[model samples]
Target: MLPRLIDEHWRRIGFTQRPKLAAIKHLCREVDLLHPQVDDNGRRPDNVEYPWTGASGSAEVPAHWKFPLMSRLHDPSGKLLLKAAVGLTRNPAMFIR
Candidate 1:
């Protein structure tokens, strides 16, 4: 799953820059082993499902679509280093200590 996603990312961006690849690799490892499995059918009653606003309505909407990938991964505890590497936050120091 991770490899395929990374490959798709590389193809999308036209290059696999070292830092980006490294971050992707790290995230692949850091993500809980069951995280990908949850994509199958983990929708909760409390979970909100916003309408997919793509230009083409024919595009397949994922069953578990909620937030963008980056936003879903954003947290002080789970993948702060990856967030820092991606410049999602300017100050990781607060999360670190």
Candidate 2:
């Protein structure tokens, strides 16, 4: 269910594209945007054990389950992104249909 949510919202707005993805990546590096990413301890909502000790970890997350949600300058959940996408290109006449 949640996986579909990301596709519908984020990717739908062109986040999956090379340009947008690169732009977001660059924006994050240029700014000091640090979002919550499941502290190094890998604390899960269910209190599960973290699998990594940061020995040979790559820059990007291994997987979604390995990371936590956070709000950074490059956060894909900014208010502007939500509002702009909301009701975008809606047909007013459809309300009557």
Candidate 3:
């Protein structure tokens, strides 16, 4: 379910390449600019788990999950990301229904 959503969103936005772990880290930093409160403890509501934890050990886990959502939202193109996020929060039943 989640992978599909990600693939579709990326495709729609013309992101021809999937992000590497390093790129993801960069995106997280960018998103953090918009949401300083979101950390990378893997405790955020929808946090992305650090994929290279085995290679980097526990030190690589993010403090928050905002990167996944924020990576999309922080794009300078438009506010669709924000709108989608707001929609999810405003209508919980949308997914549950």
Candidate 4:
């Protein structure tokens, strides 16, 4: 959802070009990882909204654990995402087509 919104914003602003900021790109990838899509085999187990069986044979709820993507919330990419989100919220018209 966030990546879609951000991509739309970039497109609207005519900013869809190569060499996107490394931090923002990393942040987008991390966000994407949070919402894994099940493949044909239905084997994608990592998700942020449900419980799944861990390798140790224990039920693991995402909310009860700090996933790697969650930990990136304190990193540079996360900070960039937060800043961009706040800017969008504060002045949405700037990105509106």
Candidate 5:
């Protein structure tokens, strides 16, 4: 989900002018893993959107879990991404070229 959204965002901005912060890529991957698609074999059922049974037979709700990305937001790369996002929102025309 996030991976595709990020790709579209960059596509709109154009590759040459897109911010170089590597954290955007990492964040997109992490976000995608959070909402994994269950394969036809029913494997990889874990996702952050719905409840799934753990290996120990306990029902786990992803909303109750603490994702690492929340903490990463305070780190350098995350800060860069946040800043760039805010900048884009403030002056969207700056990146339209």
Candidate 6:
């Protein structure tokens, strides 16, 4: 699932100096594995339907349609990190001392 998405995203996007494959590989590794499954009950999506139209629409309009891989994984606790890899706060009081 992750590999295929990275491949597609790679084609759509380009890097300036570096090869896209390397960038995609690095990006994939950087993504948070916060929700291995989207559901709280640990359910993975079985059937994935991609967008029929290109560029015209991005968001899902109705229950019948969905954006299968639109979002990138962010920290579930909302503890986004700084450029130095020092953790910054998105949500406070989510940690134990």
Highest TM-score against the true fold, candidate: 4
lDDT per residue as tens, model 3, 1-90: 322333355666677874333444444354554443554564432324433243324444446333445445445322443444465577
**Candidate 1 — which pairs collide?**
none
TM-score of decoy 3: 0.26
Q: Could you tell me the lDDT of residue 49 within candidate 5?
A: 82
Candidates in order, TM-scores: namely 0.24, 0.21, 0.26, 0.60, 0.56, 0.19
For residues 8-94, write the lDDT of model 6, one tens digit per residue.
433455634322444344334434322333332433222233222324444433235443333322332112122112211333222
Clashes of each: 0, 0, 9, 0, 0, 0
- Candidate 4 lands at a TM-score of 0.60
Off by over 4 Å in 2: 1-70, 73-77, 89-97
Q: What lDDT does candidate 4 reach at residue 51?
A: 85
Between prediction 4 and prediction 6, the one with superior lDDT is 4
> Which ranges of candidate 4 are over 4 A from the true structure?
1-20, 36-44
Pairs clashing within candidate 6: none
Question: Which pairs of residues have clashing backbones in candidate 3?
Answer: 39-63, 39-64, 40-62, 40-63, 40-64, 41-62, 41-63, 41-64, 47-65
> By summed lDDT, which 10 consecutive residues of candidate 4 come out lowest?
36-45
How far out, in Å, is residue 21 in model 3? 24
lDDT of 1 by residue, 1-97 (tens): 4444434544666664423445555555534433434333443211133333344544334465543444536643225345434542555342231
Q: What lDDT tens digits, residue by residue, belong to model 2 across residues 1-97?
A: 2223333555545664422444343433322222244342443221124333344454333353432223433355333333333434353221222
Instruction: lDDT winner between 2 and 5, please give it.
Output: 5
Candidate 2 steric clashes: 0
* Worst 10-residue lDDT window, candidate 3: 45-54
Candidate 6 — what's its lDDT?
Answer: 0.33
Alpha-carbon lDDT, every model: 0.42, 0.36, 0.44, 0.66, 0.64, 0.33
Off by over 4 Å in 6: 8-19, 33-97
Write candidate 5's Cα lDDT for 1-97 as tens digits. 3334444567776775554446678865555567657322465556778888877899978888677678987876676567656767787664454
lDDT comparison, 2 vs 4, better candidate: 4
In candidate 1, where is summed lDDT lowest over 10 consecutive residues? 43-52
Q: What's the true lDDT of residue 84 in model 4?
A: 66
